[model samples]
Target chain A: METLFDQELVVINMGLEDFAKTLKERGTRVMHVRWQPPAQGDADLLSLLDKLK
Target chain B: MSKIDQANKEAVDKMMKSRPVWVDIGRAKDVIPGMKDNLFLHAGPPITWDRMSGPLKGAIIGGLIYEGKAKDEREAEELAASGEIEFAPCHHHNAVGPMAGVTTPSQMVFIIEDKEWGGNTFSNMNEGYGKVLRYGAYDDEVLNRLMWLDEVYASVLKEAVKLSGGMDMKSIIAQALHMGDDAHNRNRATTSLFIRTIAPFVVETEWGKKTDYDAPRLDLTNVSEYFGKNKATAAAEVLAFMHSNDLTSLNAIMAACKSMALAAHGVENSTVVTTMARNGTDFGIRVSSTGDKWFTAPANVPDGLYFSGFKSSDANRDIGDSVITETVGVGGFAMAAAPAIVNFIGGSPADAFDATNEMYEITVTENNNFNIPAMDFKGTPTGIDVRKVVEKNIVPRINTGIAHKDPGVGQVGAGIVKPPMEMFIDALKELAK
Candidate 1:
């Protein structure tokens, strides 16, 4: 299983604990975690993903 | 015929016809009658001035006693009611007042003229808050201080202004704005800078006057600390700056906020609000794009702590021109910069952050100078936009002082509250016009 952090997902609506647990269940190590709400009116998920990367 | 039209007309008329003249300290004598004895001038839209707030009434009574207008408060009140004394707003008379902002004919006024705009403004001497006249408390001590300000401080300022060739307040305001002051509530840095620039000249003038001045006997040590030491002086300086521009700076913010909110006015899809103001008697507001109409609700009682011996019961509804600051993006909007203010209004550091962040949902820009360091150097949210307000369903927050709804109680506590949204909706209807 791949670590969630390795897959680079920007999680919204999920708490840090739940995301970490889900990643562990998948046998993937999540690293380099940061959380911030999306900008007021931006809609580009890929750009958001690029920012996370 | 609409209320918005009437209010807009009144605002515009005041703005256009009133030609503010910048007067030299000495020349100000001619414009504002009996100004040497009392240190304050009136302000706001010129109109038929009426009975003042209780604290203002109290201050005036104290001024009357100080000026020997009456032997006591009862006598002074009787004289004031009898119309023996004329009433005027600090703005109308080219002056600003602190606290009760009361200035009788005998008061001295600091006069600043806008060289470019030809606008002039006045402010009375700062009495320092806490059971003072501006807060509507009238007593022997308040009266006595008025006497000193009139007799000693005003005279000193007059001489200093003459010797220094006149202080350019406009320059000071520009600098202050750059240094994180919205030029209303947060003015510590500006006040300090003013004293630093003028202290030398004040001392020199005292030294030059060998006879009555008694230079050696003069207490000029804290003269430069006027803003810090005296609330009136700080307010006076700001009033002078605001008056000089014909309310350009303030009106700009108001108009900008109005324009920004215009986008969402009358939108069938939105429930956003736009503007709010308290007229001392009533709190009024408008929603996005809803032009100049005001739907007023009873002003709310502010929640916060009071000075020793004072209780919330003694406070008045929120009042003053300071609300203009909130319209354009300062005051409560920038509370994070003044965390200590939370003590006055009641809140925590986290609350301050929350206040600033909440403001962003309703605003258009972030102020460059007035910033919150605790929030990682983020600028204070600048403008309150209606679209965002409706989009996020966030009500604008205001940190305000509660004055006694009655005249005499003065101020009780500082608290946070929301302006009624009904006014915004009314304004939204006007925007449809």
Candidate 2:
């Protein structure tokens, strides 16, 4: 088993798309989460997401 | 609100309230204050001709020929390199340019005045895309089109705009936002909307004076039917050019954007960004609080898919004043408004949506006027904050056309570019000072 220090650090790019490209260029492992506004930013749906959160 | 918050709010509100009027056409030296006869303005930050990029040099040569200062390209090159002509940044003169972004003294520029803010901005007219002066192509065809725009289209629009009063640019931009126009890279919708807004007035205005040239000239007394007489042919030519060039309204829209952004440029204690522009060699940004000082870094070439027969190696570094749209919260920051733009930048609809959504992270507020439908009527992001940009480590993304690396060659691709983070860091450090 590889130790934590020996393992590659992973980057989770939550929103901005430029980050993923920049991180990749610098040789970082990045996972771009498909981050969208809650329920397509619907006011009523946002309250639902808020309750769920 | 706190003092800083209030200042930022006032700045953004002033920008949002700006109402640009299609005012007039005039020579750059007469219209733009402080424009000297020997000086030429280019886009992004300032640089002398020796260090200027290929496209910029090409545009300078083209402008010299257009102004009748030089007989041909070879002579123009010598004059430009002889330390005879001075170069200044367009931003310094309340003007903006696309691509090479060259604005010369004799060039007739579209003046967009923000009536509500009591200020004005200007830009040179657009020549339909491929092999045009803006992208550094200085062929006979490009020079001919420039002459046509200067003598014909500029004269026609000057009269028509006066006849129609001022076409309300704010409402058109508001409507275009919903109709799939990011108003930057993908402006087809905005161009069409602008045409619709002005076409009726265009036909009503008289065309052509009896000039010796066979081309469309404005005849003060020769009033006629919509398409019945020679004067009608003049109006027809302007309309024909409009219909042919999808990028026709880009320069007009850029002027409007510049007017809006200029409204927010001088608010004290506000870290809101007022400009992010590139001249192919350097990318520079201005912060509202920092006055007009520029924080610059070498421009980065965009990474994207190219047009057929062109590779990344053939592409010039990113250039243009079109990013004025991004500064005022339209371009890539509103990409979700024009998801179809993904095709132009080699991305998916999801990528487009993500780009706009992500912009919210670094922005100070959302534009209440420009609402995005797909996002359930949420306002698009607005007011880039230098502090937030550095803290979050994000920069504004620009959707731009890629020109060829060598002079006289035209656009090679369309792509997205981000100004260097260093400029934001530098701005933030200065603001802290």
Candidate 3:
């Protein structure tokens, strides 16, 4: 049953703020996504982390 | 089998063999033999006038006019008070009615027999909502439609069902359960299967061919359309199936849920809870491992979306036959699979997931067939265990149709709600005894 939770994942568009708030309230962990043109993979990841802090 | 197992089996067998008497009402005396006045017909369980909400009262008034017991709303009220008519639960009579579930003596009823066990059940013809009789709006139009159904539709269906060698409701339900229907709120799959199975016979009926009659026809207009077209037909078939197999496991689900909740039912040390049920008056519940007694409390208003022009105030407290679903681990427990349900019950996609996840804490089994893909195909938590409930201090969640506490209100909306904890406490006390 615990393993069932490990496999469960959810994806949300960056624009859904209310959805994010709801998720946080429900105690679900979240990861932020940075907006960038396709191909800026690592840069995008770093910027996303910076935005999170 | 062990002695306890034998007793359980016998109880289950008695339930399986119970049957309803069939009556076609041409007059009120035909059906209301023992019923009391001031009572109204509601589906599933018996409820009284004081416990009823606004819409339910309206339905009772509407029934009076439809039965010619009164000429106007004021007259209807007086007649109701005069104790001239009778009121009884559709369930007590082995019958089920749509929405407000008002069935007068003149209304045509389909008396279905479960050929396997000899158990029988009844249901009145469906009156499509929107100012219909079941919702307690009685006028010439409602009366006229009722007349048409009794005269034409019931006759056609009676012959059609007989012609089809009787419907195999058990098979239909088994298939529907797999097709995303709990067979309570989401009857689309069950409705479609019923039409498909019965269409061949309905097409052969006299009513099927006449263009002048303009009666609602049963056609394969897709699954959703089936619910709209011949709801009564579908309801009858489902009821028949439910009554057929003694081991249909519906009550078993309820028992299982109760037993699981027993673990947490009444630990002075525990906060986790277990059971919930509605007696049509007060909603009641029990905690895990607490026992068979119910702790009852007044039901609360449901939080959800309503049909157009309908408001929360018009809705009744939560009611229905579907609480068995919560006992077995679906309905609100599996909200993630039915995201479209959010539109009817006021919730977001995330709320749906959370509801499903929260249920996992108190339940025992996970249903394999009723899986949610968004949750990585995890099965909906199935049996609510009392131990888990007590350990976790969580009550089971239920998504239900809110009937107007008043008879005429019909259905106000669909929403998520919880059962009162008192029932569980009561049940716990009994078990402790």
Candidate 4:
């Protein structure tokens, strides 16, 4: 636990990009995953996706 | 694997294996299939004079004046609206055009043949830039330039291409990708390579080689006399004209891309997109499985840096058939290969990399030939699958030249734009059925 606290924290931030940008600005190692809600969170397209499965 | 998956694989394989070679050049009326004297081919889906944008309308008017169908702008406009002239999309005849994408029958076209698939595609000659016919400027100057290109320049280029056998466009594009060209908005490297490859052959043209089978052999010892001094002057003029314009090869490259895309079309049950083009007013796409059916939507305006006297508001909606580059996985999808393009299209080098990186999320696979060194030599994200586009809700990115909204004003800027997502969703809906 103490070693974990002493080491630099690495982060993978998803969804909003600004969160990752803020983390990197503070000297943290972070990777931003460019993300979006599948089908852009549309209900009808989501149901249609169910048909594909 | 699912049927769609297997079918899409076949389509992409065909696209990747295409070998487009510049085989010949001729007038559109002579070479293009189904092209006729009264028929004019514009870009994107089928549209009428009413729905046509200012740039496209202006180009049609210019085509009339050039064809001698009308004497002046007023007569041209009346003739265009009189319903005497027939209009169709260039894609209907296996052809592509840039900017306003107006191709009249009298214009010269580059004939590109797919050596692997045996299909031929065509595109009209590029008229350099600014106040050109493609961008809707059709004054006496534009018409005179077109006449020269259609007659003098076409004859010279035709002889050179015939002498060189055929220019391998696929290989040139592959090499240009490495030399900082996306092969669409940034074709500086492509144009340079084109000039280098054709310059030697241009000089050796059979300019004055005369033959009379029954007559006595004339003394033809002098090389300059054999290939007339007129030929030398024309050859020098041709090379200079080609060098003066950085986009000399754009139309040729567009034809090559169309050839590649056409090879991928007509595969059963595939989700691969085979065409993406806009005719100023509307954007349209065709899928392999759907055949010739076009799913269309209203085009969105571009956002980017304007010229010295222009702003974003002065720009028209996204235009041209150049987005065919993006469909075949270069253009905007391969921006990482062309960081220098940011100066013309607006953005930083990092933004360019990010743009390419984001495209991978929605594409089916990376290309085999178009490798980007900036991405650790990774291939470009290729094959836009309709299902992936809808599921991810991401639209394909396109780099384009912006024309002025009003006719005759010419290009106001260059920028990045995206087609409306509705078309992809509509395509997906049809595929699902």
Q: What is the lDDT of every predicted structure here?
A: 0.50, 0.83, 0.53, 0.87
Instruction: Write down the DockQ of candidate 2.
Output: 0.04
Q: How accurate is candidate 3 locally (lDDT)?
A: 0.53
Best-first order by TM-score: 4, 2, 3, 1
| Runs off by more than 4 Å, candidate 4 | A1-11, A22-29, B208-232
lDDT of 1 by residue, B313-389 (tens): 77665554345456545667876666666655676867876677778766655655345566676766755544344
Best by lDDT: 4
Proportion of the native interface contacts kept in model 2: 0.00
TM-score between candidate 1 and the true structure:
0.59
For model 1, chain A alone compared with the true chain A gives a TM-score of 0.28
TM-score of each: 0.59, 0.86, 0.62, 0.92
Tens digit of per-residue lDDT, candidate 2, span B140-257: 8888888888878887788788877877777777788899999888878888988887888787777633223555433223233444445345566677678777888888889898
For every candidate, what share of the true interface contacts is present? 0.00, 0.00, 0.00, 0.47
lDDT of 3 by residue, B66-122 (tens): 667788899987776665555665544444454456666666655545443443444
Where model 3 places Cα greater than 4 Å from the true spot, the runs are A1-53, B1-40, B44-46, B112-117, B210-281, B284-296, B308-314, B322-330, B333-337, B349-393, B403-412
Better of 1 and 4 by DockQ: 4
Poorest stretch of ten by lDDT in candidate 4 chain B: B211-220
lDDT of 3 by residue, A1-53 (tens): 67866775554536436666778677766654423332233453334323322
lDDT at A26, model 4: 99
Error of 3 at B431 (Å): 3.2
DockQ for the candidate 3 complex? 0.02
TM-score of chain A of each: 0.28, 0.52, 0.36, 0.72
lDDT of 1: 0.50
